[model samples]
Structures are given as C-alpha cells and as structure tokens.
Target: MTMRNCTLFYSFANYGLNKKGRRTGKATLIHSLRLKEQLELKQKYLNKSHELMRTKNEINVEWDSSLSHANLLDTPCGMVPLDTFTQAQRQQLLLDVVEPPLLSTVNTSDFGKIKSRAKYKLSDWIKNDSFCDAGIAFIKEILASEDVVNVQHSIYQFNLFDMKRKSQRTEQLVSYINAHNTLIDKPKTLNFTNFQEVLFKIPIVNGIGTDIVSGKEMMQTMKEFIVHFYPDYPIKLMLLHDDERLAHENTGAHVHAFISGQNALTGKYDLRIAQIKKVNEFLFKRDGMSATLFSETGRLNYEQAGDVAKHMQEMFYEFVNEHLFHPKNINAAFHPESVRKSEKRKQMRKEAKLAKRDRPFNYHTRLLEDVDSLEIKAKKLDDKISQREKVVDDLESKAAYLSENCETLIIKRDALEQQCIKQEAAFQQNQRRHSKKIRLEQEVDERLSTKRKEEKKLDESILLKQQKHTELDSAIAEKQSILDRLSVMATQALYPIQKMLEHMNNRLILKGRAGAAEFMQHIIKAFSADLPTELRKTLIKITNNTGDTELENALTRKDSQINDSFDM
Candidate 1:
C-alpha cells in the first residue's frame, strides 16, 4: 500500500459523497472558503469587544493552580480572554480543541505483541535524568546519529561415539546408524572413522508443564559411553538463545552453551551444548515482523529467539544455510529500518502539535471564578427573602383581628335601636289617659257653681211670704177685742172682717227679689249634671231652714217618687 497525502482533502474541508457516487469536492470547497472568511471577520469584531471582561479576579485568585501562569505562546486552559472567541467560535474551543489526541498510545496489549507502548508512567520511570554529562552526551549523540548495530546470542553441542551390547547388537547398531545420520550428518561409511563427537542436551525447557528428559541422566550416559567406546577425547557445548530463567543447576551447565550432567538410562555422557531440539527447528521456517516461528513441540513462538544448535559444527552450518542470505537490491520500501524510522517521525510530529495546543488563551479558569461568585450572591439573597416573608405574615394577622372587632360593634348598634322603639310606644299611651282626666275635672266645677245660685234665690222668696202671714195675725187679734164689745151689736162684726184682711195685706209687704220660679229654673240648670245623691239632699235642707215640714215633705215625696220610678 502507498501513503496518500491528505492535505487536499482539508482544502475542501469535507468532500462529502454525492448521489452520483462522486465527491462533491468543488461545491464544498467554495462553501468552506466563504465560511472561513466569515469566521475570521467575526473573530476580529469579538476581539474589539472583550477589551476587559473580568471586573474582578483578586478575591478568587487563590482558587487558581500553578498552571494559571500563562506564557504568551501557551494556551492556559479556559482562562483565556473572552476576546479570543465569538459565540460560535467559543463552542469550537470546548468541543473540538479540548478533546483528546487521535494517535495516542493504548495502555494495554494483545497476546504475543512485542512493542513498547508509550505509557507515561513507564516513561517517567525510565527517564534517565542524571547530571552525568558523559553518559547523557553519548546517548544524545547516538539518538542524533543514524546508523547502528544490533546483537544476539546462541550455542551448539554434538556426540562422540556409538556402543552395543552382545545380546542387543543389532538394535544398538541400527540406533547408532540413525542417530549418526540425522544429528551427526557426515560421510556415509559404516566405520567409526566416519563419525564425529560433540555435546548437546536432550530436553528443551521453559513454558512447558514438566521436564520428561533428564539432562543429568543423558549427560552421564553420554560421558560413560564416550570413555568406554571412543575414549580420551573432549566435547564442546552449544546454545541457540541466551535465557537466564533456565536452571543451569550443574556447574558444567552454568554457561548457556554447554550443559554437562548425568543421564539416568545411560551411565554417562558429555553434553557439549545447550542446543536443545527447540533451538534447531528454525532451519526451514518463516518468521514475521514480530519474529514469529515454532518451538520444539511445533507450537508458535515469538520475539527475541531462533532455532537451537546442539553442536558447534552443526550450529555454525545452520546459521549460514537455513536462512536466505547474500543481499541483492529488490526495493527500498517496507524495510524494518524504514518502518521504525517513520514511526519515530510520527511521534515527533505529535509532540510539535501538542506544543501548538498550549496557546496563550484558556476559558475554564474564568468560568470557575464566575460560578463561585454567583453561589455567594445567591446565599445572601436567600436571607433577605426570608425576612420580607415574616413581615408580610404579621400584617395579615393584624387585618384578621380588625375584621372580628367590626362584627361585634354591629351587634351593639342593633340592640340600641330596639330599646328606642319600645320607649316611644309607652309615651303615646300615657298622653291619651291624661287628656280624658282633665275633661272630667272641668265638668265637676260647673255643677257646684249652679247649685249655690239656686239656693240664694229660694231663701229670699220664703222670707217675704212669712212677713205677710204675721201682719194678718196682728189684725185678727184687734178685731176679736172689738167683736166682744159688739156681741150686743152682732150684725155689724161681719162687715169689719173684710176691712181687717185689707189692712193685713197692706202691712205684710216685704223686701228682697221676687220670681221664685226663676230661682228654681237656675237650680235645676246647675244641678242637671249628675252629682252624688247625698250632696243634692244636703243642699235642699240648707235652703229650706230648720226642719221645715213643707220642704221635708217635698224631699220625702221626691225620694219616694224616684224609688217608684225605679220600680216602674
């Protein structure tokens, strides 16, 4: 695959897929160009406005951290001046600018992967920041330079001779022939001169469940077999890779090359190399970028290892012939050095981008300060609201009390109105009774006056009648004296009686007013109004004088006649 430059895509901004299955590159490009110009214009206007957005920051200065100190070239989080952004531009700073990086290193790896991840903690740990100028200068110089060499380690071993017992001569001979042909590849002659001797261990170790082939038993068998069968010679050891985790338990196996130990079945042997079967199987295998191949048991293996070498001679041959060598020019691309170099350049570019991100404006710090101030003001407002509510409640209670008092006054007014009405009715009845009593008293006084006038007239008339009677008596006495002397002259006495009556009448003329009938008429008028019967009888008796029979008779007759009228 070839790497394509993506700078042209940014020119269109987003060359979206169209309905015709082509990129709408030209249309979008014109639109994006116009939008960019508009954004730039808006940003210019924004810068003029903010001039000074912050009214105060001194009270909230302690809330800021060490990063708040801004370099002119560094972006100091959200504490930047408001002039840096417009309404739309501000949204971009939060959603796009503050986001994490796209090519950042992952923290975990899959199985069999062999790359160093860019973990910050690991980098901190390995940061060799000593004041050692010599070591530091050397490392810096190496990093600045281009060419370098890499190194690795391996080992080999072989066998010396063959042996057989009398009873199993055929099986031992055949075993010796097969082992010599496979491991000890040499001249095809059946004689001992054609065989060669070296050392190697039988079992491969590490990442296996158990060790079935004992190195000690094999080493002892090989050593004794060599001394008895071939005698008086030495063998060297070989290794495929250097691994310290293996148990070089025996003194002779301490070096990763040769492992000399006793064999259980064979009495003795000399293992000249730690080149186990796992170390030799890489002869015809293919390996990948992470160095993947098969182990001794034919499962896959990876990273920092190759095939085993059991003998010095065989170990040397396998290295030269098993892998393709002798270089010829094919292509300059896809080389391991080239790939690694490009990865380094990518990391350098990312570091430069981060430097650009640390610009001179940030908005988070300003936002935090404003929020703190708002919270303080809100608390003060809450206290004022509580005080006003209490005052309103007191006013409502007073209004309720006043309303109740008004109702009580209305009841008292109604009662007073009822009392006034009853008194007026009583006064009207008393006035009517008093008017009737006055009329009755006036009638009684008129009756008393009339009775007194009638009595005065009746008493004068009675006195005149009494004087006339007295004169008539005196004249009669004078005539009687003369008649005695004239007894002798009798006839002449009758004639003198007439003359005496005339003289008595003339002498009996009395004083006082006349008209008794007029007096009686006035009495009747005065006493016509009803009076007590006892008072009426007393008036008659006073006017007639003491016990006058004529008057008493008249009174008795009047009483008797009035009683008779009652019966009728």
Candidate 2:
C-alpha cells in the first residue's frame, strides 16, 4: 500500500473565554494534568513494546547518550540560560509560585463578574481580569530584580486584537528596567516588539493502531524540528487541547499550540505550518502513526465537489482578462504620461495603422482615388480637343474668301486652291482621329462608372455583413456575461449546501454508517429537483456526460465493505 501524504488543517479563534465557559481559562489546568497522565501511560506502554522487541531480537538495543536520564535531568523546560530544571520542576514552579498569586488576585466574586461581562465586553474583561494583572505584575517584579522565572506551564490566553494593548502594558511595566539598564549603558534584552504570537492546530487520528509517542513528546519533537529549520530565531511552544474538538470526543483530542517569538522566515504563518505538516507526514509514518484526518475523497460529496470546481472556473474566467494578453492591467501598472511617449508604444500604434491600411475598406478607398485621377485626365483631353476644333473653323473661312477672288489672280488662286484642298484633307483626318479618341474616352468613362457602381454595391454588402458580425459578437459577449453572473450566484448558493453536506458526511463516517451513499444520492436528487427547468436540464446533461466511473465504483465498493463489516 502506498503511504498517503497528510495535509495540515489550521484555523484561528477569538482570544478570550466567553461568559458561558466555552473557552474557560481553568480548562488549561485540567488539560495540563490530563496530558501529564497520558504521557506517563504512553511512556510505560513504549517501554513494554521495547522490551518485547528486545526479547524477540527484532531490533537493536543500542542507547544514545544524549537521551540518557542524567542529560534529561539537566535540560530545562523553559529559558535554558536562566534556569536549570526538569519538566516536572517547571510544572511544580507554576503550581506553587504562579497559581497562588493568580488565584488570590482574582477572588470568586470578581471572577464571576468578569465571566458575566465577558460576552458583552471582551476587551474590558481582559483589562479588568485580576488574574491576568497579577501574572503580568509578578513577571515584571521578577524581571526588575534580574531573577530567573519559569512560568511556561501557566497558560495565558489573550485576544489577537489586544496584542498592541498588552504590548503597551508590558512596556510600561518594563520601563524601570529599561531605564536602569540604559543608565548603565547596557543593551536592551526584553523587547516585546520583536515577538509575535502564532496559533495552529494539529488533528489527532484515532484507530490508526497504537501510538508510539505521547502528545507532549510529539510537541517536543516538532519544536526541535522547527528549531533545526530556523536556528537563528528563538521560539517557545505551548500545547493546549482543542476545546471544541474535545467537546465532541474526549479521547484522542486534537491539539492547538501557541507559538510565541520571532516571525517565521517566510513571514506567512500558514506557510510555516504547511511546511511542518509536509515534513511531519513521513516522520509520523516512521513512528508508526497515521497523520491523515479524512479519506482520500475528503469530506465533500460529489455535488459539493462539482460546485467547487465550477466556482474555481468562474473565478478563473473573471480574472483571466487581467492576466492573459489584456492591456488593462498593463496600462494601469505604468505611468500614463510615460507610456504615451514610449518608443515601443509609438511603434505599436504605427503597426496598428499599417494593419488597418491592409483591410478591404482601404482597398475600396484606393479604387475611389483612381477614379478621381481618371476624371482629371479626361477633362484636360476635352479642353485640348475644343481648341483644335476652333482653329479648324477659322481656316475654313479663309479658304472660302480665296475662292471668291479666283479670276482676279488666276495662278496664285490655283496654288491657293491646292493648298486649301490639302489643308481640308489634313483637317478631315485630324477630325476622325479626335472623334475616335473622344469615343475611346467615353468608353473608358463608362467602364470607370461601372466599376464605381460595383464598388458601391460591394461596400454596401460589406457593411451589412460587418453589422451582422458585430451584432453576433455583442450577443455572444452579453450571453457570456450573463452566464458568468449566474455561475457566481450558483456558487454562492451552493456554499452553505457544501458545508452542510460535509458536516453530514463527517457525522455519518464517525457513526460508521452504511447509508452514507444512499444519503448522498437522495441529497443530489432533491437538489436537482429543486433547480429551475433549464438549470435542471443543464445539470443533468453535465452529470450524464462527465461521469467518473472510477470514483463511483470506488465509492460503491467502500459502501459494500462497510456493510460487510457491520454484518460481521
């Protein structure tokens, strides 16, 4: 069997305890004691397991010197440089030195009043709580005296929003110390600004076979792992039982830890938690424990999964234009003044103009320009022809006059008559040539007129086609926009449905029910029936076409196995 990798789950909660005791501070004391007992029991079991392995010669019995009892005794549970004490000693210090002052500062009546008003005024509760004030004062006193204090075992819950307020109070308390150190020209050691609080959860998987280590030991190992990864930053880890998860199941409760110190290297706390989970999967496997909280299919039903997939696709479509070749975001990213004068931008505009010149519309424009040029040439030819005709008429009148004086000057008249005949003949030839040229020009004009008419018809047809194309494009864009909006609405509607289904699935699984498959089928059918006619058809179509036979078969097989187990 392949080992499945585990994913980490984490969530944040509001800081203080509520009036109804949902998140009571006293629960911390109970959790500490319970954890101690559980750890001792686990240690005993592990020793027995080791002995059994040794007797069977299944494992080596070599002992590491670093984990020896003497070394463990010297290891302090809190600040290592300030104190030399074991885990037990640290717990004792908290119980004896811390609890006395904490309990005395907050009497029963005052505690009652704080709890009653906590729901309405959480900030006031945090500020007025005598227990918290006492703890803060006690720490300040120790710090002022430059004495080592180990109070790691005492749990102090503060709302994340109140960190700034708490920091201010801490600074006020430490002002004396800061002044005294400054007077002596010493470096500041207690700066609250350098630290931050991080909260994360680790779920415990039950019925995964016997646990090899206790929760405390697991926490210690995880802390060491983090320290190994981030050696420069100093960190402190405190484990607390998840109140909500524990309410559901007292045994094998989920773990919540508070990490206080410098921020993670990536600056994202969730990313740091994810890294820990990824590495811890193999670590947990090696230690004979399962880290997974749910099955491979997860808690989501098929419909819920489909809804999530659809939601993701809608989100992708919505943002796709911003990232993919669209210039909107690009234009927004740059300064408008700079972009307007940019050489590359100018080149792009020029290229666009050149592209427009190559269109069919531009070709029609060139044809119109050719027709105008032809008209100009024809007008110049007509003017030259008119001047030639006037010259011919003047020569004819001169010839008539010469004939009238024929008897007075006989020889000269004969010569003039011959000249007149020759000129008349040449004029006739020139007239025929001009007439032919005029006829040819008329024909050319007719052809040009026909071409102009054809171009006009073509332009009209092109315009009509373009109008239709534009309408189609607009219709498609409008439909797409509507579809996107509907998809978003559907996703929003399905979110709560998914959550409810997930919750149901988890409950069914926990109860070891064989009817989970039936329940899911009923839910899908009911949901489909509730949809509008068109939406129902679409849903049915998608379901019929996009069926995953493998997943279905696996679910069926699992259901059958569950039934068989119940039967047995």
Candidate 3:
C-alpha cells in the first residue's frame, strides 16, 4: 500500500479504543508489535533520505549471527533447518512495520472467584481446563532456556506458515480460507475501488487482516490439542508485514500470527521476567473463558480470545513437542528448572567399574582349563604303566624259579657220574678175591692126591714083609727051640722075627727106594709124617713112650734092612 493507505490503516485502530459503545464492523488493523516492524517504521518515519542505509541496517540484522556457528548437519525441527527469522529480525525485513503492547500475565486463582457472575456461569464456560494447561506448558517450554527458543524459530517453517517459501505462504492462506469458509456475502454495495476498504474499523494485533482464526473455532480446535496435547502454555499473537513485492497479492492482509511467553496474570515476561502488572488489564474483557485471558490480537473478542489462546496454545505445544521440546532435550519435564545438573558423577561411576574389570587374576582362564586336561591324561597314562610293571615282575619270578631247577638238574647229573665210578671199583676187587680162593683150593687137592699114592705103596710092602718074616722066624725059632728047649722056649720066637725082617727088606727095596735098611726106619717115620699131623705125632709119642718091646723090634728091622741093602 501507499503511505496514505498505511496511515489510514492506523487511524481506524485509534477510533476503536476511544469509542466504548460504538459498534465497529470488522476491518484489518496494523497494531501489534514486531521487532522487525519497528525497524521498518524507523526507516519510513525517521530517515527519509538514507534509503540505502535502512536497507543495509535491515539486512545486517536479518543476517543471522547464529548461521556462522551452525553446521549444515544441524536440522532445526527434525530434518531440514527452516530459515526462521526472529521477531526482531522478521519485523526488520518489512517496509512499513508497527509495534504493539506487550502481553499481560494472570494468576491462576483469580478466575475461580469470577465464576459466581451469571454471564461467567461455569456451565457456559468452555471446557478449557486442559487447554489452559496446554497454554501453561507452552509458556514454560519457550522460557525453559535460550536453546529451546532457537528451536521454536524453526517451527514456523512447517506446513502451517512459511514466509520463506512463497508456495507455503500461499498454501497457508488457502487453508485458512477453507477452514472458516464463508460464502462471500454480496455486499450491499460494491465500491469498485474501495469495496475491500473498511466500513467500520476492527482493532487488530498488528497488520491489517481478517479474523482468519474465529473465536469459537479456535477454542474447539485448541481444546483437543491444548488440553490433550500441551496444557501449560498461554498463547499470544504478534504481527509482521509482507515483503513489499508480495504485499498487494494477499487478500486477508494479516501479516503473521505468533505466540508469547509472558503470562496474562502479570504484565511481566512472567515466564521470563517478573512484573506486578495484572494480565486482565491487557486482556479482552467479556464473557466465557476469553474474558479471563490476554489478547495481543484484537481479532479475538472475549470468546475469540479464549478460543485463540486455547487453540494457539495447542498448536504451540504440538509444534514445540514435535520440534523444539524433544524429550532428550530435558532431564525432567515435570520438575522446575532448578533440578537439572551436569553428568560428571555418572561418568565417574562408569569409569570406576571399567577399572575394576581390568585387574589381573592369579592365572589366565584358558591356561587353567588346559592344565586340567593335561592332569587327566597323565593319570590315565600312569595307570597303564603300573599295569605293565606288574606283568614284568611276574615274568621275572618265573624266570628265577626256572634257573633254580636247572641248577638242581646239573647237580644230580654230577652225582650219577660219581656213583658209576664207585660201582666199577667194587666189581674189580670182588673178582680178584674169588680167583685167589680157587687157586688155593686146587693146590690143596694136588697135595692130598700125592700123599694118598705114597701111603698105598707102603701099606703093600709092609704086608709082604710081615708074611716073610713070620716064615723065617718060624724056621729060626724051630731050630732055636730045639736048642733053647734045652735052655728056654722063648728063643724060637726071636728067630722067626729075623727071617720076616729079611723078606720085608727085599720087598721094600724092590717097591720103594734103594736105601731100604735105613729107609725102613725112615719110611716108617716118613709115613707117620705123611699122615695127619695129629695122628702122626700121637703115634711117634706112643712109640717113644713104650720103648722096651717096640724099640727092640724097630732096632731089629733097621739092621735087617741095612744088611739087605748091602746084599742087593
């Protein structure tokens, strides 16, 4: 729009604040504050000649210092980092930007007291308990930390609204129109040039726009997401302008709808800074829950504010939860910010456990297992060796016994040879003794035969002598008897004995030896000697003892034999 159009847009906003009872028909307003809008206003109102300077100033602010540190690998929401401009940075990009009042904060308990009012009847009140909770949560989340806020910027690039991509911006406007789809009511009159112009001015947050988001509608959509999805944060909308090039193309004329962190109970950045101002002063005062909360955008009346806060809070938390508020980003969502801490303690404990595991043992586990196996095998081998040793001992005993038996056999053989030698010597001695006895017996038999022959011859000679001697003795004794008869009769016996002697001598000489006389006496003695020793001795002794007659006879025979030998 031209300069005159921008001034005219602001003029309608002042009129609504002054007239209490005047009913103003809905018209777009450029009221709410954006830090970017201030920079635009600074260029237009304050510096007319430094056009290049303003552009440079705006560009310098828009160029994010954060981009220098950002790694391309860094994804803001989830996948791709959207080029999210800040409120200050966003407003700085537009040509004719504006600033609005800061939001209000409310204490939660005050609303319970107002419930007694009939218009504020609890039954007619929307079921926004969960929605309020979601708003509270959204507020808490943005104010959680600086890093969390950075993530929130990336969220604006989602399907809902994206100023960077013209396609997304176009899509957002189309979707918004479809959601509240109004049959464009034929105007009572269409002023061909100014039909889209205001009949009655409607006060709005910042840029001129329709209530694209309805009050009842915002509450209904918000109740489900805000109450069910996120229930702690309160929602607020700020405004921004279009790029001058794209401005006229937009029909609804709203710049940007966004959220705030300051609670409505207090005029401070309650979630961020602390202030005593009550949230009600800035809020749209009316019935239903809307009368209870703040409205940075004039589009929401009492009901609309309630609904917008609820719906926006829902969308805010959804975006925050889905993008900015990842669970890994916080230690405890339920706790106050006071409870978070550094992780050094946990790291130290883990390191201690690892050190303990690295301590050495008495031996390696694998070596122990191998040693056990070796011991078992050695025992088995020892058993086999012991059995073999026993067998060797048994064989040695048998061999010892055999050696003793062999020695005994050798001794027996030697004894047998000695016994054979003794038997042969005894046989030779017995044979010699037997042969000597036989020779002695033969000599005795020869001597006995010779003695017997000699005795027979002597006996024959003696008989002859006795016969002859008897004849001779008888003759002699007869002659002598004739003579002796005169003297004695005994003389005749002596004469026969001499004659027998002479005959015996002759016979003895022929048969015996030549010396008969001496032989006769000797023969008698020899005969006697030839007889048995005992008988011969006894006869000689008897002859000697009786010497008278026997001696005379023997003397006579001797003389006769001597004479006969001479005569022969």
Candidate 4:
C-alpha cells in the first residue's frame, strides 16, 4: 500500500471510528512541532557547550634505547629555556639523564679518628682520593648543571626512588657494618658502601620440615621470626625457586631473609647463627624445631649463583616478586608516594577508555542526527493533519444528509429487530443440541479412559503370570535334573550288590555238588562192608541214587532218616 493510504487507514481505524480523527490529528501535529522545537533548542545548547569545552591532552613520550645521549635540538630550540619547551620535549630531555655511577666515594680522610671515636673498624670506609682526577671532573659537571638540579626531583619521582629514605638506610647500614667489622678476623673485608656485592644463603633444615612447608607459609614464618627475635632490625623475607625438596629438583619452597645488617661484618656472622638457635630454643624447645643457615661459600660456588653480584641481583628479584608481584598489577605498598600517584592516574585513564567503549553513541552525535529527523517528521505530521481535516469535513456533510432520512430508517430498524429475535431463538436451540453432543462425547471419553486403564492392568497381570510360569518351569526343570541324577546314582550303588550275590550263588552251587558226591561215596562204601546182602543192596541203591541228581536225592533222604534215627 501507498504511505498515504497506510496513514489514512491507520487514522480511520484508530480515530475516525470514534469520530475524533480531525481533533486527534491536530493535537498530534502540534505535539510533533513542539518536540521539533525542543530538539532544536537542545541541539543549539549542546553545540554551544561543546564549543566552550576545551580539553588539554598530553602526548606520551617513549625513550630511545640508544643510551648514548639526548638528541638535543640545535641552535634556535636549544637556546630557549627548558621550561619554554612543550611537555613532550621536556620528557624527551629527561630520558637523556643516564643512571648515576654505582660507586660515588665521599671523603674519608679522618677515618682513623672516626674509628677511634666510635670504637669500630674503619676498614670498609671509602678512603680519600679513591676517585681519581677524572671522577672529580665528572662529579663537577653533574653538580654544575642547572637543568639536572631543576629536573632532579621529577627524575627521582619518575623512577620511584625515595632518596631520603635510601640515604638514611645507607647510614644505618654503614654503622652496622663498622660495628660488626671489629668482630671479623678476615684479611679481605667487605666494603659497607657496596655491601650489595656480598653473597648470602639460607639453609633448609631437615629437622624443621622446611622442605614440606608452602612458600607463603615459610615466608610468613620467617617474618614472624624477625618480628619476635630481632624486633629492632629491619629484615625483608622472601620465598623463591620452590623445587629443592625433590631428589631430581634442586629448588624448593625455602625462605630467604635479607637482613640488612648481616653485611655489617666481612666474615660469616657466627654470632647471628647462635642468636637464631637461642631464639628457636626460647620459642620452641623441641629437637627438630630450629632453622639452619648454609655458608655463603657453597652457594657462591654453585652454577646458579655464578658470582656475588648476580646472586645479589637474583636476591633483589626475589624481593620484588615477594613484595610487588600482584596477579593483575603491581602492589604499590612499598612504592614511593610519587610513583603511587602515577599508578592511580594510569588506572583512571584505563577506566575512562573502558567507559567510552561501552557507550552506544556520544551525546553530541545523537543530538545532531535527532534535530534533522524531528523536523522532517513534524512536517509530515502537519501535512497528514490537513488531509484528515478535509476528510472529517466530508464525513460531516454526509452525516447531515443522512439526518433527513432518520424516521424512515427507524421503521426499517424495528422490522430488522423482529427478524433478529427469531434468529436468536434458532441459535439457542442449536446451542442446546451442541451441549448434549458435548456431554455424550465426554461420557464416551470417560468410558474409553476407564477401558484403557483396565487394559493396562490386564496387561500387567498377564506379564506377572508369564513371569511366574517361567519361574515354575525353571524350578521343575531343576528338580527333574536332580531326580535323574539320583536314579543314576542308585543304579550305580545296586550294581556291586548284584555282582556279589551272583558270585555267592555260583560258589554255593559248586560246593553243594562237590560235598554231596563225596559224602555219598564214603557212606556207601562203609555200609557195604558192615551190612548183609539185603542191607547192602539198599546201601547200593542209596549209593547209586547219589549219582547225579537221582543219587543226590536218595542220599539226602537217607541222611535225613539217619539223622532222625540218631535223634530218637
């Protein structure tokens, strides 16, 4: 559809149907014009404020790696004062300031007098004229430079170096070294000024179970020891390279406490070891409770230690890891105030960048686009309001013409009402029939649901019977197998008895034949000798009867008669 038709149709459906189309369109057009004016005013205000807002941004300067010297701008630029240069130019100049030399000796001409007054060794003191003629000239150049002094504070702050605190610590350390120096017997002594050149090592005592302790736990324990035992001394405890406990690994979670006063003397502090043992005995009297310390000689010779300077450097790194290492950022607890402030500024800048990224569009960008779009929509709405007003006028004219035919229309409305009444009655009848059909369908559904439940129950019963039948069949099969085995066993048991009975029967028959024949022969011969002719004939008959079956029967009968005669 055309835009005009779509707008008109929406107007007719929403407003024309309620007979308020013209009024609503006029009100809408007025509101749109007001909105356009407000947006234009807002746009003007934003533009004025934007013009007034002046932001100064700094360009970050990065130092060049060439450490040789600053590339000073020649002639015109170099002649200007350092303050006249932009911040970027100044930062570049600052990079030219090289690190100061490690060994800057001060005058120690009265070392002997000072040592006598303090009653301490002055062996480690920097002797006068330690720095040759060239060193003095270099020192003079640094002291004379006006730019160096002017930027000295800024340079220190940038490097996060607290020079005041550093100086104080150095003095204290020097005194400590001199005091302990008198106690050492070594010919070659440690220089307190460069005590950082000394090597230090802490042992993991097998008895103390240090090998099994966590790095953090061991560090904390060492801190506690220093706090309790040497409350006056400042000690920095750290944990490094935790892998020493394993046979293959040469590192473990061992605590290394860098005691600042340990280098006060050149020789190993045997006295400190004794003190440590005393602390352990005081705190824990148990046998395996003491911590041990290894000699610096062993650690100094090890491959990892390499040299005293490198070992000290590693110790510094370990200190940094313990004190400054945070998961996402550096911990500034030990940092100087100036460095902490710089860190805060960097964090704020990061957060601002994140906020800018999250915004959908800047307010200024939205304002410019909204001003143009509002004016266009307002103009369109005005034109729509005029067209709708014309349509409303046309509708009003049609309504006036229809007003003249009102009576005639009212008569036809009554007739239509009567027809509507009849239709309503027919609809009610149909509704009642539908209700009855719905009721019948509901009854049928209920019956079907009940039948389904019965069918499910019957199926379950059938399954149960089948299961029982299977079990019974299994039981019967098992019993049948047992009976068959028993029958076989009974037959096996009866076979031996049957064989013995058969053997006895055969033996009895043989014995009966042999014995009967022998007895009949003996009786017949003896009787024939003792008897007369008639008696001998009878005996012969008996003897003849004993032959085979007939003789056996006659002899048996005669022996029975003889046995009967003996009883009489």
Point to the candidate with the largest TM-score. 2
Better of 2 and 4 by lDDT: 2
What overall lDDT, based on C-alpha atoms, would model 1 receive against the true structure?
Answer: 0.29
lDDT per residue as tens, model 4, 1-568 = 2111100000001111111332332222221112222222222223465435422110000111121121111122222222234545433322221111221122132332343443222122223335344434433443333231323442343234323344543443344335333322321122221110111123322222333333444345445544554454344212222322322222223333333333233333232333334434443433355633334332233543233323223333344335423321322122344853697645743553332212333222333343444334433533443364345335433432433232222322333343334334432443323553365456545645654565555554564455445545554445435433433333332232223222322332333345645544444334322232443344334333222354446544655565566579
**What are the lDDT figures for the candidates, one per model?**
0.29, 0.35, 0.30, 0.33
- The segments of candidate 1 whose C-alpha lies over 4 angstroms from its true place after superposition are 1-369, 402-568
Clashes of 2: 0
Which pairs in model 2 have colliding backbones?
none
Residue 16 CA displacement from its true place in model 4, Å: 99
How far does residue 228 in candidate 4 sit from its true spot (Å)? 1.7
Q: After superposition, how far is residue 443 of candidate 3 from its true place, in Å?
A: 99
Best by lDDT: 2
- Candidate 1 local lDDT, 225-274, one digit each (tens): 33432333322221111111112111112111111122223322222111
Clashes per model (N, Cα, C within 3 A): 56, 0, 44, 8
Better of 1 and 2 by lDDT: 2
TM accuracy, model 4: 0.16
Clashing pairs in 4: 177-264, 242-252, 243-251, 243-252, 244-251, 244-252, 545-551, 546-551
Better of 1 and 4 by TM-score: 4
Tens digit of per-residue lDDT, candidate 3, span 319-395: 33333223324111221234213365345434433311122211122223333443344334334433643453354
lDDT for model 4: 0.33
